[model samples]
Target: MSTPSYALRDSMTMLRRNLKHARRYPSMTISIVAMPILMMLLFVYVLGGALGSGIGLPNGADDRSGYINYLAPGIILMAATSGAVATAVSVCTDMTEGIINRFRTMPISRGSVLTGHVVGSVVQTMVSLTLVIAVALAIGFRPHATPLDWIAAIGLLALLTFALTWLAAAMGLVARTVESASNAPMPLTFLPFLGSAFVPPESMPAGIRWFAEYQPFTPINETVRGLLTGTPIGNSGLAALAWCVGLALAGYGWARIAFRRHAKR
Candidate 1:
């Protein structure tokens, strides 16, 4: 086989291995998926009224359905981040185990190992995102988006998933243990709260509002929300794409460096 063929075969093997691991230990993925759903239910049922009123819902009235529609995009992003955290923990575990050393001694492509984790994580993220969206739809989260808007939203999500999964893989490489790896991605999970995920950034205090408006998550959130609700996306879509691409490149470089250093040690 050619070099490319060999790499593809090796990567596919690793991808299957990772997928099997996910199947055997489904708890992590389940927990990741559950968090977003629970948060959605909590906010929509419990806090929706107050938050809707505070945000001044469309037509100048509080409505849970309106809030649900606004909140679904953020929760979907949360699901993606949570899945990334799962990737970090899984990668950390693989690094700590003897299997990675064994693979290094074999003829398999080195980069395939990282590729497997990233691809698997992205798949898992997509599943979680789908489930969250299904739940949102079931709960009266109606979107006014056209088919083109849906395509754009999915594309944006795929990009975000790729970037975040790679970053999580880097985090895994940097962590000495699975516990640390698990914790490393926690801040990402919390980032949505600080962005325009649930409430308008303008409603926040001056300092907080500045951070919310300027942060990467805010633009991404806004873009997704706009795509779903027929709101004008303006420059947010471009900003979100830029952030995803930049982070992906940075994380890919970092992961490669970390892996090389680990191999040397």
Candidate 2:
């Protein structure tokens, strides 16, 4: 009989293994962190003034500082997404390389193997998020969030990371190749751009505006902005929470089913 304590112990051991693998091949982590940072620099330095003015900021025509505040949350959201690809790739690599089959022959909890990948990916995502936020703070982004607000914002990001990591795990399991896994989560990384990440939904065209208003990232971005920058969340908070919970549950179910099917095969 597998006890909860034994499962936790097994999961932790698997977590250490995944962490070691990450340390051995750090190019993925570097790329994941570098992309958002580059995007931040591009938007803040190159296009900030024009975009800021387009958004109707008071001094946006001349100053890029105001745009940084608006763009910071989205970039952080990007940081959350950037790791999904890495997670999917790593999970798929393990599956294709026959390690998952080897694990099946071991005397460990079945769920612990996936748990390790999910938890390790979440940790990596949070670390990347911290780096992005640090860069944001260094580069003229100023958030006026209170302590509680900061806590809520971090919690939301963690929840988002957890949800996405699980989904990526499922994608990894379903993917037939490592290359396919790498590409599967590309849409997730770009979802924020189509939403209100860079501009308000009002600025987009009719069809895009509808999508930007209704997509999951827009509300999540809005809730983060409200928490960090004092923007009005209104009903977006509830919507964001709903989306996070729904995705997390769906992803968990999907990953479990995929893992079982693969185990049987």
TM-score of each: 0.98, 0.97
**What is the per-residue lDDT of model 1 for residues 84-110, given as tens digits with 9 covering 90 to 100?**
789899999989986789999999999
Residue pairs that clash (backbone atoms under 3 angstroms), model 2: none
Model 1 residue runs over 4 Å out of place are: 59-61
Candidate 2 per-residue lDDT, tens place, 1-265, comes to: 4599889999999999989989999999999999999999999999998888777743333468899998999999999989999999998998999999888888889999999999999998899999999999999988989999999999999999999999999999999999999999999999999998888888889999999999999999999998999889999999999999999999999999999999888
Instruction: Give lDDT per model, in order.
Output: 0.90, 0.93
**Candidate 2 overall lDDT versus native:** 0.93
**Segments of candidate 2 deviating more than 4 angstroms:** 58-62
Would you give me the overall lDDT of model 1? 0.90
Give residue 6's error in model 2 in angstroms.
1.3
Pairs that collide, model 1: none
Give, for candidate 1, the lowest lDDT window spanning 10 residues: 56-65
